[model samples]
Target: MTLSAPPVPDNDLMRYLRERGSTRNFKTDPIPDAWLEALLAAGQRAPTSSNMQVYSIVVVKDAQTKQKLAEFAGNQKHIIDSPVFLALCADLNGPALACEMHGTSFHGQTFEKGLVAAIDASLVGMTISLAAGTMGLSTVMIGAMRNKPLEVAELLGLPPRVFVVFGLCVGWPKTSPIPKPRLPMPAVVHQERYDASRLPELVEQYNRELAQYYRDQNRETPDDAWTQVISDKYSKPARQHLRQHLNTLGFGLE
Candidate 1:
């Protein structure tokens, strides 16, 4: 049997996605409460594993709290600048409560359970980003929320089995930046199998493209920009205590 492809027309959503860039600088104007609610509602519609919905979003608007969170996130000004900072968290607490209601114990200490929660959180976060884009709002995801996981959790008053996977800053853009170039399709897409033969070649090609992109933006970067940045970042152990911290936060990650 043969399958036919649906004829899809070009639309604003596709254009917005292709051209969207991480927004670091944001206007101080607050997002309307109605808009925020709509965005969160859209995010909840994201597909979840087994309808578990094992994720939660903590919305932070207090200046002092944002200030503390900014410090915890390596002094990211965007976290403090954006009118709203969203802590997208992977939560096992709700599932545990559900099990209790049923008079059964929830064994969510396994790595698979931890992974599923993270995936669920990530899906919702991406959906929120897309929804925000549609509303002419911009955003940046802060993975630095994990830089000091324990401190972050403490600041947010997270309970056991609930930890922030990342953060999202949402607001109007203060300055519009062009989207960074991504790896070519040949580098990322494989034809029904894993491919590594062209990795080196692809890396070399992407380095040139990325370096030129930086140059055009008047940013100084090495010729081997991508390779050097990644190597320097990974040369030493990164977040060496992350596993212990996660365990302390009650994510078994076994």
Candidate 2:
């Protein structure tokens, strides 16, 4: 992959969207402390559910720790090579303890509540990615943290009622990866009636477009484009059912 300067930001946010790509290669240059701080600050500035902010970010920087995380992520080298790795967690311990200290009872820690926390953490994580991109940094989201939820929780020293939601890699880009193809706008957006009438037609057009995109990039052609990919995904062996796992981790999915 060859590197290239970012496209200048034009009127319609084209440059911002075009230049952003998941970067895997990173130079050995040490990331500046202020830039790291700025990234975290941008994450903190993102919206939270009811301002509870029941989430946390664990910075993984030590070589050994990064290796451990990388191993957990199926030995994805980028996890270890990136200057920083963040384990975004959904946390209930903070609010629970805060309530305990104040002699106040908090009963909103339901499965839905946990969902909100996870969403908040994810939103913050993506904000960091955007902020990093704006500053010429690169990033990749790691959903593989859920591969071994229990192990990740132990590695991060997460307390009861706190669990790893996802991971992220952040660093300067080494090369410019081409932007992946996306479905057309109309395929996603809907008006008041929630019109899904155009789905079949839209899917067909998108499949053709995506196949062309793949061919242009010299990538292998997908069998049936988006729909087939999604069908195959669900057809695969099931992943860990989080309900029971959450029981051990202190999330009452009831």
lDDT of 1 by residue, 27-139 (tens): 99999999999999999999999999999999999999999999988899999999999999999988999999999988998899999999999999999999999889999
Summarize candidate 2's per-residue lDDT along 166-223 as a digit string, tens digits.
Answer: 8999987788767877777777888766888888888888888888877897878784
- Whole-model Cα lDDT of every candidate shown, in order: 0.93, 0.83
Each prediction's total of clashing residue pairs, residues at least 3 apart in sequence or on different chains, is 0, 0
Q: Which 10-residue window in model 2 sums to the lowest lDDT?
A: 11-20
* Candidate 2: regions farther than 4 A off: 1-14
Residue 189 of candidate 2: its Cα lDDT? 88
Per-model TM-score, in order, reads 0.96, 0.89
Q: Name the candidate that leads on TM-score.
A: 1
